[model samples]
Each structure stands twice: as C-alpha cells, then as structure tokens.
Target: MFEAIKLLVGVVSLIMVYRTITGNCNKYLAFAICAIWLRYFLSAFHTITYPSLVAGFSINALGSIGVAGLGLLLIPTAVFTLKKLFPFYVFFTAIAVSGFVNMQIPGTINVLVKWCYFLVLAGALFLSIRCQGQNETFKKLLVAFVMPVSLQMLSIVLGEAKATEADGSTSYIGGYNHEAAFSMIIVSFIFVLGLVNRNAISFRTTLFTVAVVLLVLVNYRTAILTILPIAAIFYFTLVEQRLKPSQKAPVLTIVTMVLAILFFVLSLSMQERFADVGLLVGNLDLIFKAPMYFSDAEQDIMSARVYIWSQYINAFTNADLLHQIFGFGPDSWKHKFDLYAHNTYVSYVYEYGYLGFISFIGLMAYILTASFNLSNKPLGKILAFSLIGFMIMNMATMPLWNIEGLIFFALALGTVFANPSAQKVSKEIGAGHKTSMEIN
Candidate 1:
C-alpha cells in the first residue's frame, strides 16, 4: 500500500514538473514537485537495504520509469519550444535517436534509459539557449527550477551526517552522497545563470557562497576539483570585469591560498585526536605521493582506469561485423562486468561501437557550436561553459547516468535553451543591446 502511494506521488510530481516546464501553470509548482521528489527519493533509498525487493524491483523499475518520464517531458518541451532559436535541436534529436537504436539491443535497457535521459537533457539545453533572449523574468524562472533541487541536496547532507553520527555507518539512501555531488554541479550552473542575468547579483552571490560551503562540507574531492577551473574561468571572464580598479584580485587569491594552507596544517596538527581528519590528511598524502609510490602501490589508479578502458575497447573490437555496426543491445555490458563501463567514452564505444560513437560526438559538437555562436548572451555563454565543464567531469565520473544528475542537467539546459514567445519583448524593453554584445 505504501509503495503504491509512493509511486502515485512520483507520477503526480513529475506531471507538475512537466506542466511547469511547459509554462502551463505557476512555475513554483514544478519547484515544489522536484523538492518533494528529491527528499522522498533520498529518504526511501536510505531506509531500503541493498539487493532487497525495494531496491532491485520497485525502486529500480518503477522509480526509473518515473524519472525517465520526467526527462522525456522536459526534453521535448525544450526542443519544440526552442526549435527556431536553436536549430541544433534537430542534430541533438538525431543523435538521441541513433543512440536509442544502438541501445535497443537485448539486455541493454539500462544503457538505453541512460541515453534517453541524456538526450532529453541535451534537448533541454538547446531550449535554454533559445530562452536566454527572453526577459529577466524567464531567467529568474530558470533559477527557480534549480533552487529546490539545491535545497534538497543540503537536506540530504544534514540528514546523512546525523545518520552517520548515530550509527557509525555510511548510508546513501537514494544515492545521496553522489546526489550531493551532482547538486553541487547543478548549483554551479545556477550560479553561472545568475551571473549572466545580472538582475539578481545579490541572490546569485549568496547562492554561490552557499554552494561553495556545502561543497566543502560534503568533501567530495573530485567535485571540488572539477568546479575549481570553471569557477576560475567565470571569475576572470565575468566577475573580474565588474570589480572596481581598486579591488585587488591578487589579494583575494593569496588569502584563499593562505587559508587553504592553514586549514591543511591545522587538520594535520589535530591528527592524534581526530581520526577522521587524520584519515583525510593521510589520503591526501597518498594522493600526492602517488608518483613516488606508483611501483609499490597495490592499487594503481591510473593503471586500473587504463586496464578497464582496454577491456572495454577490446570487447567492442572483438564483436562481429553486425554487432560492430549496430552494437550489442542495451545493458549488454552487464553480461560481462555486471555494471556500466564507468567512463562515458568507453560506455558509448562499448554500447554503440564506432558508428554510434561518431553520431553521439557529432550531436554534442553541434550543440556546443551553436551555443558558442550564441555567446552574445551572458546566460548562453555561461550555459555553454557549464556544459563543457560537465562533460569533463563525466569522463572520470558516471553520475551522468544517475536520476538526480540527469534531472538537474535537463532543467538547466531547458532554462538556457528555452524558446521564448517574446523576442520582440526584449527589443521593446531596450534589452536588445545586452543580447547583441560580443562575449569577449
């Protein structure tokens, strides 16, 4: 009975989000739905045990279907809405279709699901680029889409920390640890969107600050590192110009550097009493000493990745001609590894072979090229950069296939690529110049 109610709530929530994306109702309704979904999913995951009926059957099947439906609704709304503003929607659709075909093979439903979700997000991103030409109200609406997700992430972090303190065990109900990292990525995009809009400087700054603090608390090293370069690019290209001549960029940089050094030193100094801090520092030390220990280390990170890549590559190459061209059907990798390829590039190669790989790359290239051309709009530029950052991070991480990650990515893309009905509205409001200026 409880399971049925949960499933019903999921369906209703997704409908609300879809309506919000379509501009058919109050946008806040969509935000509420996303927040509820995030919270419920997290709690549900935490309470359910692994390999149990709930995890393997109910959550994996019905829950995945609900998430996939949400993606489908958003992607179409983004593409159809922005078809005129961004012609790349056609190319993205083509790639998605090609991927779907390649993924349709037996035992590959999981892979197909992932491709469907990603394609939806790509389409939504195209729409977001289209909508950037609209007024500030549209931009605010985009931010609203992400705000609830971010708050839900914060809640997960707090709840997870409390659970850990009480039980002395790690719990990622609904994959909260990974979702938290994914939320950081989404918040980073929101920060860029806020920067581009410029109408909400204070709000954006506060959110960015909150995101940074949360990121630190979560201590997801890869996420922190992945965002650093993007933050640097944003600071230099966008934030620095807005600063007064008297403001010292170097001072801020030095202060951050000094604080980092002090924090590390303090953490090491307290190693005797704080086993957690000691473990963290010890891990950092090992990472730094990787080069020196490469020969002796039992597990070599770089070598392990190369080995995995080689295995996937060899598997694809050994396939028969028909399999090579059409690829092993969706979820085929499970027969061999019982899991995904772990690397997106390898995953694509393994699932779709070379033909599908080219088509996927071509679609990504098309969207990126179109986005670059539309860089005149701050929001467009930021979205383009964020996508690039996301792609880089995905090379080493598989969060791209996760539900929370896909939803956030799709929503952000939709915001940037939205097709507004009010092109003339911007011209009448004297916002045309802002949209027409060169990014550089």
Candidate 2:
C-alpha cells in the first residue's frame, strides 16, 4: 500500500516536472515541490515493505540521478550575474578548489552527487522568480504548501510514529529522521502560507494552525522555540502600531516579556496534554532547566553531538593552510573521522572550509539583506521571515539538505530575489504597501 502511494506520488512529481519543463510554465514547480513533500509526509507510514526514506523510495534511491527534467530547463534558463546568485557560484568554486588542496580528496561520486543536489536548488530558485511573474503559479505554490503540511500534521493522528534506538537515547522521531525539526519547519511554512495569502484569520487557516499545534505537541521538542519569535513578529506588527516611536525602541523588551508568558503557558499546556496521552517527554521541569544548559559543561561533554562537533572543529583548526582554506569535501570528514558534525553550519565549514563558507554566507547575506529590507510588505515579508526561520533551524539540524525543503527555500528565494518580482518587492517595500494582499 505504501509502495503504491510512493510510486503514485513519484509519477505525479515527474509529470509535473515534465509539464513545467515542456510547457515553459514554471508554476508547476509548486506542484513538484508538494508532490515531493507528500513522499516525506507519507514516510510516517513506514513498514517493512516500504522502509523510511531509505534507498528505492526517494528519487535517487529509485536509480535516478538528481532532478533531470527541471535541471535541463533551469540550466538553460538560470543566470548568475545577479548579486543574489553570485555566492552560490563562488561556493561552488571553493568546493572545486578543495578537492585539489585536501589530502583526502572527496570521492568522485560523493562530490558529484552533492553538487547535483545544490544545482537542483539553484534551478528551482531561478524558476521561482519566474513563477512570481506567472502570479497564478506563485499563488498556487503558496496554496500547494498548505495541503502537504496539513496532511503531514494529520499523519501524527493516523500513524504510530515512534523513534528507533539510534545514537543512544530513545527519542520520539514523529516520522522521518528529525520529526521534531520537520514539524517546526512545516509549521513555519504553514504560517508563511497564511501570510503570503493574507488570509491568516480564515477558517481554512485556523484548521491548519490547529493541526500544526497538535503536531508540534506530538513531537515534544524545543524546536518550536520559533513560536516565541513568531508570536513576537505578530505582536509588533499588529499590536505595537499604537505605541509611540520611543516605545518602539523598547519593543524587544515587550517581545521578551511576551515570549516569557507564552513559554510558561504553552509549556504547561503542552505538558498536560501530552501527559494525558502518555507522550510527554520532559514537561516544564525540563524546560525550566534550560538555564542549566549554559552552565552544564559535564552534560555538554556527555552529548554525542558535542563530541562530533569538537572532532570536526579540531580537524579544520589543525589542518594545513590549503586544507584550512578549502576544507574537506562535504561529508568527507565523516569518512575519516567516524562521525559528522550534526550542526549544519559546522558541517558546511568542515566540508567546504572557510572559502566555501564565505562564498555561501556572502550569497545568503545578499538574499537575507533583501529579505530584511522587504519585510514591510505582506508577501515579501512573509517569505523573507519564513526563510529566516528556516535558516535558524539549520543552525542545529540539516533539513536544508532535504530536497523537498530545499526546493521550497529556493522557490521563496527566487520570489524575493528574482527579476521583475525582485524589483517590484523593492518598490512595494519602500512605499510601505498595505500589510495584507488579497489572494487573486
């Protein structure tokens, strides 16, 4: 049954990609993104017949290389002269240079596969901007995100999602690897959808938000920390309008207070709800203990991640000048060190070195700068902030590598930085366009 579902989703995805390429109708990117996401959400139904996102299930596992149909179109259509795209090429150059400098050159297949995955993101991003020009496609993509996200939330109720014993502890992996992280990201995207559509107060949006809230509880994680940040964004945008400019400077203090109250109420409520289901992990006691994290060197030392991160940092710090500049190839450290840094930023620095890091960060800096500057408008702000939340999540986890998620990010980036839309966003932001836009 699961295999059939997976196969069906795969077929639909391919068809969408084909239409997107042949038709020169870029809006189909939305369909492809969701179709791929459906596969991720369906992983909640993992059984022996169809194991979780292992080989044979994902596109690559199904004996295909990285995305082919879209790649052909994107390769021809993508331009990198734009300041927003310069960083990716620089990062690519850094990665290529690393192979020659590092003693343990990254394996051919390993390097190629990694490059293909990133190329897919670049392709999707290029089209995403084009999608905005096709307003219907851009709107459709926004709407398409909601279905998979809501269904993914529904999966919590439908499936018996429990974590397996890996690393050491018995964690609650709602479905795929870091179900908690996945939930956090999905929920953020849900909010992005609402804001993008400017229909956050609607019943449809309410239903999805409730499901997301339920799913967040199911995961029993601090990944929902973004809620504090999000709630603050909402408050300042909606509430602080009546305040004087002097009061606006202290908005952070108000935001901090709001977060404190929210954390208390939310933690208590989540604890009680989860406890009723026999699913609560740590309750507020664990949360209140967060301060201990700052002082708890012993606990940090005991953490497997700390050990992994240390090993990675030491390798770069101790390497020769060339290795330090270029770093090991992506995942190359894991082959030699027996462990990989679980942190994405740390992992990137280890895999590509300072040069790669600078190029990548420089590129994102441009994108993010634009995102920040455009936060005055509705869709522009929504997509920009959504990207911000995604980046924050990547600080601790590597969900960005997930193609479904990566494609979504690229699409959003394009909407923010791509051609006519990018210019439009700047003008709109400068003019302080209305806070909400009707979904046309």
Candidate 3:
C-alpha cells in the first residue's frame, strides 16, 4: 500500500517534468530541484520503512539514475560555468584531487561520483533559472519542496514510529532513517516557507508549523533550539510590523511571557532526556582540549560524540603529511572506526584532509557571506536564516554528509542567487559586456 503511494508521487512529479519539457509549463528549473527532493523522499522512505537491504540499495541507485538522467535532459536548456561559481568550483576541485589521490580506495571513488552527480544537478538548476525568470522558477521550487515534504511529514501521524531511544521512547522519524535527519529536513522546510511568506502566517501555515514543532519535541529535542530563530523571524513578521511604536513593547512582553510559559512546560516534559544535553553543556570546556586527555566519563558524554570526535581528530593529527593534507579518502571514517564522526568539521577534516576541509569551509563561508548580504531584502532574509540554521545543524550532525543536507544547501543557495538583486547584477554585467562588444 505504501509502495503504491510512493509510486503515485513519483509519477505525478514526472508528469510535471514532462509538461515542463513540452513547454506546457516553463518551470523547468523548479522541476529540477523537485527531482532531487523527490529522489531523497523516495529513497529515504523505502530504506527506513522496509527491512530489505537489497531493495533499499536498488531504490537509492534508481533514484540516483533518475536525478542524473533528468539533469542531463535539462542541462542543455541552460548554460553555466564552474569557474564563475567560485565556492563550489574550489570545493569541487579539492574533492576531485583527493579522489584522484585515493583512486584505489572504493569509498573515495564512491564519494567522488556522488559529488559529481550533485554538482551536475546543481548546475542544471542554475541553468534552468537563467532560462526562466528567477521569481517564477523559485515559486515553483517552493511548491515542489513544500508539497512533497508535507506528504512525508504526514507519516508522523499515519505511520508507526520505532524505538530510537534506550528509554524505550518512540521516535517519530516520519519514515526517514534517523530522527535527527528527519527533523533537519522538516525544520529547514518550515524555515524556507516562513522566509518566503514572511509577511504573515496563514491559519494553515500555523497549523502545519505547530504539528512540526510537536514532532520535533518528541523526536529530536535539540532541534527545538534550531526552531527558535524561525519562531523569532515569524514573530517579527506577524507582530512587529503591524504594531505601533508604543504598542510594540507591550505586545512583545506578552508574547515573551507566553512563550516562556510554553517553553517551561516543554522542558518539564523532557527533563529526563535533557539530562544528557545538560551534561554536554556542563562539559563544554572539554571540547577545546585534546581528545587524548578525556577521561572515560568525559568520553561517554553526549552519546559518546566527544570520544568519537576526539578519535577522528587524533587520527588526522597522527597521520603522515600526505594523508594529513588530503585526508584518508571519502568515508574513510568507515574504514577506521565503528561509528560516524557525528561532527561535520571532524568528518570533513578526517575524510577529505586539510585541503578538502578548507575548501569545504571556504565554500560554506562564501555561501554565508552571500546570504548575509541578502538579509536586506524580504526573500533574501529567508535565505540568510536558512543558511544560518543549516550551519548550526552541522555543529553536531553531518547535514552536508548526506543527500538531505545537500538538498538544503542547493535549495537555500540556489534561491539566494536567484533573488532579483543577484540576477539584476548579472544582467547589468552582461549588458555592459554587450555594449563593449558593439563599440569594438
């Protein structure tokens, strides 16, 4: 039954893609973004709900094929170059070099291929925007994302959750593999929607948001912190703009009190779970120290993230110069350790090496700078906060390490560059070049 629902969603998305190809709808770029999201939804749903390893692998492989095939079909419709996209270009180069150096390693080769596929997918989306206007293309992107995510989130209510916690508490993963990943995707989507519709919250939007927050409360408690910014932004949109100068302070006070009460209630409900969070906070200083110095008790904190992170960093530090520079190929952690790095910074540095890490950081910094500049505009502000939230998530979890994280990165930055200001600059530059050519 569930399989049929998945097929139906895929078919509908393809129909839209078909219409766009036929010129029935010019939302080619939007459909490209949808293609990636649909791939993630289908792959994740199948992998988590069913226990068949072979079937899961097949679904993921097919999803990759679909994404690549669609990218090939749409890329020819638009043109872009890697050099102009400086951040991604440098980062891509670093990964490629690392992959070449570690070509014999199966994991590195796999990582290299996936990165290439994602880069092509992103390029196709960018080209599509160049062909169609950014505004229309972005609106379609929003619908493409929000609609599918809404369906996936519906699993929170309809599907049975699994026991993800040792306490026997159920985790509402919404059919995704892990609650953390599920929450990240949901929060990012809500953040994107809030940013696009920043002026006011509709009744439907409020309900959807409340439902998501409730899910977060049950599944990943840490995401609750991430949602604060979204809530603040929404508050400004819903109340700050509408209030008079004098009325603003009083209303803000009332809202603050209400939120405080609500937060207090939430904290009480999750007191037991939050004990680990408190321990991590209390031992925050340990993060600055060398992992070798950690006592057994310290290593056990934050679900052993501290110990895991220390091990990765220690391995990198102990490696020879060549491995130190390029790191041990992609997914190298899998070869050396039993668990994931849990920290993206640790993961990148260990897997890609210093050069790859620097390139990745440079890429993220470039994106954040672009996002920061967009804060002045209405739509740009959404892009800014979304990027911030994604970075915050990376501190503990590896969002960029998986397809979901990459999807958020592409969607957020793609929308950022697609904003009117960015597009206008490109247009002016093109016009200037054209005029110079005419004079020549």
Candidate 3 on 1-440: residue-level lDDT in tens? 64556556656666755554555335446556566566555655665533534633456655665576666666643334534376776776777677678763556655655665566556655555556645445444554444345446555557746676435677765455676666666665665466444333346357546645655644666566556656655655566667899998989888878777877887788787667777877867666567778888887676677778778888888889998898787776776799888888888888778998998888888777776665246455556666676676676777676665666666666565544455445665778843121100
Clash totals, every prediction = 21, 0, 1
Question: What is the Å distance of residue 391 in model 3 from its true position?
Answer: 0.9
Cα lDDT, all candidates: 0.49, 0.52, 0.63
> Which candidate number maximizes lDDT?
3
TM-score per prediction, in order, is 0.60, 0.67, 0.79
Ranking by TM-score: 3, 2, 1
Instruction: In angstroms, give how far residue 63 of model 1 lies from its true place.
Output: 3.6
Candidate 2 vs. true structure, TM-score:
0.67
**Which digits, one per residue and each the tens of the lDDT, describe model 2 over residues 209-327?**
56446546445343454344444455445545556878876875776677678767877865632232222132323212333243444224323344455566766777788677778
Best candidate according to TM-score:
3
**Candidate 1 residue-wise lDDT, 159-202, digit = tens:** 54323322233322223334443444444444444445445445
Give lDDT for model 3.
Answer: 0.63
**lDDT, residue 340, model 3:** 87
Sorting all predicted structures by lDDT, with the top scorer first, yields 3, 2, 1
Better of 1 and 3 by lDDT: 3
